[model samples]
Target: MYLYFEFAKPKMKKKPNKNTHKIHNYEYYTSGRYIDYISRPSAVYIQNDNENRTTLLAEMDSKKLNVNLFMKSKLLINQLSEKHIDGYGFKEESKKLEGKTGLHKLFEKNLIDIDPKEAKEEFKKLENNNQFIWEITLNPGQLGIDNQMVDKNEWNEILNKHMKSLLKANKLDPNKIEGYWALHSNSKYPHIHLGFFEKETNHSNNYRQSGKFSSKSVERFKYLFENSIKTQAEYQNLFSLKNSIWNNRKEIKELFLSTIALKNKQETKSYEALSANELKILNASKVIANFYKNSKSKSYAAAKNNLEVKEAINDIYEAIVENNQKLALAVTKYKQEFESINKAKFSDKYSAGLKDEFVANEKDEFEKQIGNIIVKQCLKMNAKEKEVQTSLNYQEKDLKQDFNDDELPIGLSFYPYKYDEISKLKRMIRSLNYEFNRLSRSQKFQALRKYKKNISGVKSKVIL
Candidate 1:
């Protein structure tokens, strides 16, 4: 995930000139005059101070700091040795396998000398548990307009400084968070890949026990890196020029707008297929938001009579039943225990409200009070119960060829005797499609096993 920070506009003139009746001279930051200002010699006069730092930030297309953070239980040595290190810009030409310096060398050079025997012994302690291998990418972008402009040696030095600062800020020891890093310059956006396995540090006074970066720490790292980059004279000027050119380009703006539209369309479609629990909360919220519009009387029964309100209640009830059986059972028990009391309470409230004449504001307040109770109950029951199932199975009937063919496929298959079984299978397939559409990329990746199995096979067939 990326972390974003809004840069402060210290140059912004908040007040207008009273005598001259002139507007605030906020030309340094305004997007409209940005192109014109940059084109003229006057822009050179604008000093690179705290005031225009935000303008520099605004000019950049890639505003947020990106850290592609990953943690795996498997060690990096095995992963790298097995040729499993794909997509991290590891080249085939420079690759070494047998008797070469591997991930272990990173420690010796950058942090500490980790003896192979000692490291293996330490790893054995948490061999079966979540012994993590952290893989991270920092500042995955072009150094300058032309990659040639950046000095590789200087860039590496600055990068190392920033990375160490980030680690120190997050309470990670350079020795403990040891990893191998390689800068891949072949790509347009030059990036570095860092890989390391977690080691138990006996020096509790120095290193963090977990050797982990929390979300908050990551956010802090993002800010620190951005500030560090800005503070450096070489990078600040290079990036400022590049970003101004990028943001002022017409094609970039058009591309961004088109991308945003497509994203909005996709999000709308996904939002339509919300989870049962989400739908309940959404419907309830809508009902509460529009409570004042309906219900002329201050009566709870009057508010309940509204179709939207009634539907919202029904949705909430269904959500509660589906989400939490225990909560539903408790409510069921409450109804049984205070059956007479609830009935009497309802009658009293209805009679009292009907008999008295309340103003529109009072009626609105009364409606809110009644709606609040129902919404609260629904919300209380809407907690998601953890699902621990490992597999999701769905069957597909192979209708590509003749069903009675002798030369058939080779996989376990079954024939359903009853019509309801076929119907159930169809329903299962439909549900899978619905879920696949609604789910995020990560969810789909996790559920790929089910899709891979269900998509290609048919029941009642076995051919090799």
Candidate 2:
């Protein structure tokens, strides 16, 4: 069992808090294992350390923190609305609850029907000076169960069952916590929102507060709610569907890259082993390859069948292994066809710098020219002898004399120490090299291509 409420162990000769003897228990499922989590003694203060918090969160991640479902749980304090009660009461806001079930108005008891206008008064009476509201939202598609599979009635049943246990863990009974809850199907994803006022300790006294919750209480409630989603085969199927849709473009790119490597006779055991990411990509790539083969007759029969794409990809790979030129050409041609399709399939943020086509080609040409120029420049510079210092002190004296003399060019001349000369020459050469490399391939090609443009006549400057 996991411990939701933690404690700092007592030190030597130190007595534990008497209140620590009591234990709080709750049930939740984690990593496919059903667990009954218990709380530490109430008197034991929780230790809050940044490093420890990070470590705990990482461990929670390993446990699949959300139980494969998404839950948004929060506490809202001092947010009162007359419309909130009216909406729950199915007033003009009845349209919001039209087809949804589990939508109802809550009361303090079986009596005292709190109207929309009296919501603030009733909430203030319960909360007194420390006023707040609590909210919980359970999202669908997070659980393996399809949102459509569960009808409105079944959805309400699930929410009520989970809500009871959640409130019980926090020392509040669902019957006692005056709140409004409704299941909303109008959203893209089905979810239920529960709103409630904080309960005060002494009902007769306004100053006394009770039924408050700790951060741990909130966490336990979340865990209890997530585990309520029953695991089924449909969950796994839904997960696969979501994964494929999310990684569609990514898989395509990886598959294409892998196919290219195999075509060039490169070692690809790493790709062959196929990690989860690579496998998805390879599957997409194979689908594209299969589509290429059937494109000749202007018929893409294989594209219509998702299952056949894998087999088709395999056939194309085997052909490439046998050095089939026709198949290679087909695959290459298909890659071009899919370029625009791929761009349209993904967003600009995801597809950024995917291809260097124009900019890249120009940058490559420019950098190559710059490298050649740098080599020639370096050789020319290297041919000259570096100034040698006969005496260290004598060199320093010469530099001081140069600096003192006003006869040197206003900005051109400076004291030339050995290091200064080396740095100056290095900076000039480095700057030229960097500038050339920095130019876009197109820019470099354009600049150097001009020299070649005059090649029909007397060679202007020999093209690098």
User: Which candidate ranks first by lDDT, i.e. highest?
Assistant: 1
Candidate 2 residue 422 Cα shift, in angstroms, is 99
Off by over 4 Å in 2: 1-102, 106-130, 144-150, 198-216, 231-464
Candidate 2 lDDT over residue span 1-464, tens digit each: 12122221112122322322432111111110111011111111111122222243344357564421211110011111124545556464444323322233443222121233334344334322343345344454445233222233334444566567666776665665656544433323445444554344334444213334566766665565554444222232233333333344244334444555553354443332544444443443433433444455322232332223323333334433235454445445444434433343212322333332422343233223322322332222223212233355567777776565466444444534433455556657755643453344336546656765676655221111
| CA displacement after TM-score superposition, residue 436 of candidate 1 (Å) | 99
Q: How close is candidate 1 to the true structure, as a TM-score?
A: 0.24
Q: Which 10 residues in a row give candidate 1 its minimum summed lDDT?
A: 66-75
Question: How much lDDT does candidate 2 score?
Answer: 0.37
Predicted candidate 1 versus true structure: per-residue lDDT over 1-464, tens digit per residue: 13321111224334533422333232322222222221222111111112233343343324342211111111133324334446444554124322222123343323222233433343344334333344455542433322222223333455566667666676666666544444333333434434444455535432233435666767766665544443343344434443433343333224333432343254332334677676455545445435644546533455443444544555544554445555445435433433322232212333334223222233344235434445444333232111211111112144323244244334323433223455456557756754554344335434654555676653211000
Error (Å) of candidate 1 at residue 317 is: 97
